[model samples]
Target: MRLRSCLAALALVLLGGAAHAAEECPAKSTSMDDIIAVLNAAPGCDRAMKLFEACEYGASGDVQFGEIVEKKCEADFLGHLKPPQKLSYQRELRVCDRKYRNKSGTIYISFTAFCRAEVAQRYSRRALKAGGAGR
Candidate 1:
């Protein structure tokens, strides 16, 4: 309960920078793997696995998780940036919620982010130390 809440907060905080990083990387198919890789590198393998699992899915089948939120945010951002020729100095992000299911379980998450630019480089050092970049 409390721990999960705290972890969620931590994830949100960590996500701030990651969202920006994704903007810089502009996750085009191949970049999705890179984004996940960066997240995997942020922490050691074991911790990364735990975080990844938690973010990907929560304890309950009814609740949305961090991973879904992030993915939706990223997608929203890309949709807005479509055609790529409309890019400008300003940037923005939009997030949405979604749900999915498998034979094993039901999943809920928010997956979206939008922006005209990226700030991944700005927090590169801190992210490395905080284990956000997976390094």
Candidate 2:
């Protein structure tokens, strides 16, 4: 009887903790500006962006390309965008893939250099014209 009660108490504690964690996760905000703001505010944005860029290059057609590289890039980007504690990585990756499916090479290049000022300055102009900046 004592063991049964202990197990039930432990289960309740675990469920309560999960509920608290879910409440702490930020709701997905609308708009690119808001999304960017959230990303910029995060601690590992720069590192995550760098990892994403490196993985992206490996995944590109110009490299020794394969689905594996692409998958790695997608996973890394989603992982960095919102850590596991805050977001569902698989769900986020699916949404990201859908949004980026028809993007041009130039826009892809812009994202690859998102952390660099000069590259962004050069590409932002073209991206603006291509309707890649924001909708």
- RMSD for each of the candidates: 18.1, 17.7
Which parts of model 1 are misplaced by more than 4 Å? 1-63, 83-135
lDDT of 1: 0.35
Model 1 residue 20 lDDT score:
65
91-110, model 1: which lDDT tens digit per residue?
Answer: 32221221123224332221
Candidate no. 1 TM-score: 0.19
Q: Candidate 2: where are CA atoms >4 Å away?
A: 22-33, 45-135
- The whole-model lDDT of each prediction reads 0.35, 0.39
lDDT tens digits, residue span 91-117, model 2 = 443454455457776455343333232
Measured against the true structure, the TM-scores of the candidates, in listed sequence, are 0.19, 0.26
